[model samples]
Target: MTAALCLFLAAINIATLLAFWWDKDAARAARRRIPERNLLALALFGGTPAAFAARQMFRHKTRKQPFSTYLMVIAAAQAGGALGLALA
Candidate 1:
């Protein structure tokens, strides 16, 4: 179970990173882009680390209003959840 969970998280993070990269590329090409909700959903589903890394690496969605705010909130909630688990 632990290994499976780790594998799932790894896959999701990779997918999230690829999504961010693709979205950035699409933006540069003026093409259809990934939706903000989808990105946030990825982050909410154990892809937060990749989301942050991709944001910094690609310089994507760094200063966007509400998106940044939403990301931060999600990060905080995840952190809190992890802390609670650790404590428990």
Candidate 2:
């Protein structure tokens, strides 16, 4: 909840959102797309909320197997971690 942590999260989330937008654009243009692992890494590093937002906003990667599953898992883990911190 500190200012620095909020700033970092905001920056990462914005980057994640932009990455998704770029990937969707690339997909439409048949260009080289962003890697799934990189996208997941962004989510893992505090971009989960923005990842979900981008997925819904761009309608991209919604049905991808393993990727959707992984994103959900990451979100769940993040929620649990946050809950743990709150309880602690």
lDDT of each: 0.97, 0.99
Q: Clashes in candidate 2: how many?
A: 0
- The parts of candidate 1 lying over 4 Å away from their true place are none
Write the residue-wise lDDT of candidate 2 on 1-88 in tens digits. Answer: 8899999999999999999999999999999999999999999999999999999999999999999999999999999999999999
Residue 50 accuracy (lDDT) in model 1: 100
Instruction: Pick out the ten consecutive residues of candidate 2 with the lowest summed lDDT.
Output: 1-10
Error of 1 at 55 (Å): 0.5
Model 1, 42: alpha-carbon shift in Å?
0.3
Error of 1 at 64 (Å): 0.5
Highest lDDT: give the candidate number. 2
State candidate 1's TM-score. Answer: 0.97
